[model samples]
Structure formats: structure tokens, C-alpha cells
Target: MHPGVKTKEPDKMSPPEKMFPVLLQKNYVPQGEYEIVGYLKEAVKVKNAVGQMVIVEPEEFVKGEMKPHESPGVGFGPMEMKDGRKVNAKIWAGTTIKVPVAEAKYVVAKKIAERADDIAA
Candidate 1:
């Protein structure tokens, strides 16, 4: 071992396993299904929209898709909002979106986890 580095003995009971990092930010959507090891980074609050705040942090994930699943029979690509805006199915990894505070608390919390597994067969 190098003089500048420190080393410790392995645990007797548990063997070391390969580990991957995952990020779970507040306003950011997860790319795909991942076995989240732990919080590599904490969520940070950022100003978004009028009188609302959203979490804008990037998280680490392993072996996941950056694009969202499209439903069957959905006409064209991307999603359309009531205000005539388009929401792309492909969200760049580590990107954040501003959501309504109330919706974020209730809806996003539940949906984020399932996003990765929401693909059509």
C-alpha cells in the first residue's frame, strides 16, 4: 500500500460486491430502472416557475436508458400539453425540469420509481 493511502481489512462476514452509484434528485426524472445503491449526491432546491421551487441536481445511475417509454398507439413522438407545448420523450440524463410543487410532492414521488419499468412489451 502507498504511504499516502490507507487500507482496511475486509469484513469477515460480508464479501465486497461490485457497487454502482445512483442519483435521485427531486425535480429530475430517473432514466430507467436501476438498483440504487445509495445517495451519491443530495437534492438541492432551485427556483422554478412563479412562486415554486424544484430540485435541480444530477444523480449517478448505472445501465439505464435516458429515454422515456412511449405508449402504444400514441400518435407521433413526444408529448403535448394543454398549453400547446411539447414534452419530449427523450430527456437528457442529468437534466432537471420544473414541476408544480404540489404535483411534485404527490405525483412525482410515486412515478419516478416506476418510470424505468414503464416500457411497452
Candidate 2:
């Protein structure tokens, strides 16, 4: 035993236990409760008086394509928040976020409402 280091007695330690449950079947699907981890962009299209269609307008919009993270070993990894914070949650394709079933429905509804015009068209 080293004099500089302190050691704990075996009797004082707690018994070992599993943190997560073990699955009996190998074909089990996990519940959706994850966060989206990647870059995103919000784009809007406006129609002019002459009915001209424009894709990218620098003056009125910051146009850019939505790009995802392309790093290996990032499958079902953590997601980055709008406030530049990284959350420890598994996500899919860095786009479709696997959130709670109820929350997922809410998110979809909210998005549809926000893009009502696009849907109508």
C-alpha cells in the first residue's frame, strides 16, 4: 500500500448493480426521446408584384442550403441547440429528431401551422 494514497475498505463499498435494463430479445426498438443534432436553416419565399419567383435574395434574405454534419462515429449522437449548446441525446440523420411521442406530434403540428402557406400551395 502506498502511504500517499488513501484506499477504501471492501466492506465500505456498495454492491455492484446494472444502470440500464437488459433486453431479452434482440429485435427491440427504443422509444423516441432524443434530440436533433446538426445544422439547420430557415428559408422563406416571397412573391413580387410582377409574380416573379426568386430563390436567393441577399437584400431580404440570407440564402443557404441546409447542411448536416458529416463526421464519422456520429450516428445517433448528441445534438446542438440554437443557443450553441450541445445536448446528450441520440438523434437520427441529424435531421429527424426522435422526441417523446407526444412532443413529436406537437412539433409536427407547430411546424405545419408555421408553414401553412406552403402547405396550401
The TM-score measured for candidate 1 stands at 0.21
Write one digit per residue (lDDT tens) for candidate 2, span 6-42.
8866787666432221111111122443433223344
After superposing candidate 2, which stretches have Cα over 4 Å from the reference?
1-32, 35-94, 112-121
Error of 1 at 51 (Å): 50
User: Ten consecutive residues with minimal summed lDDT in candidate 1?
Assistant: 32-41
Give TM-scores for every candidate, taking all chains together and pairing residue i with residue i: 0.21, 0.22
On residues 1-121, what C-alpha lDDT tens digit does candidate 1 reach at each position? 7899988878778753332232223324323322323222345678877868787775443233332223554332356799997664433333233333343344345654212222412
lDDT, residue 25, candidate 1: 35
Off by over 4 Å in 1: 1-88, 111-121
Quick one: best TM-score, which candidate?
A: 2
RMSD of each: 19.8, 16.8
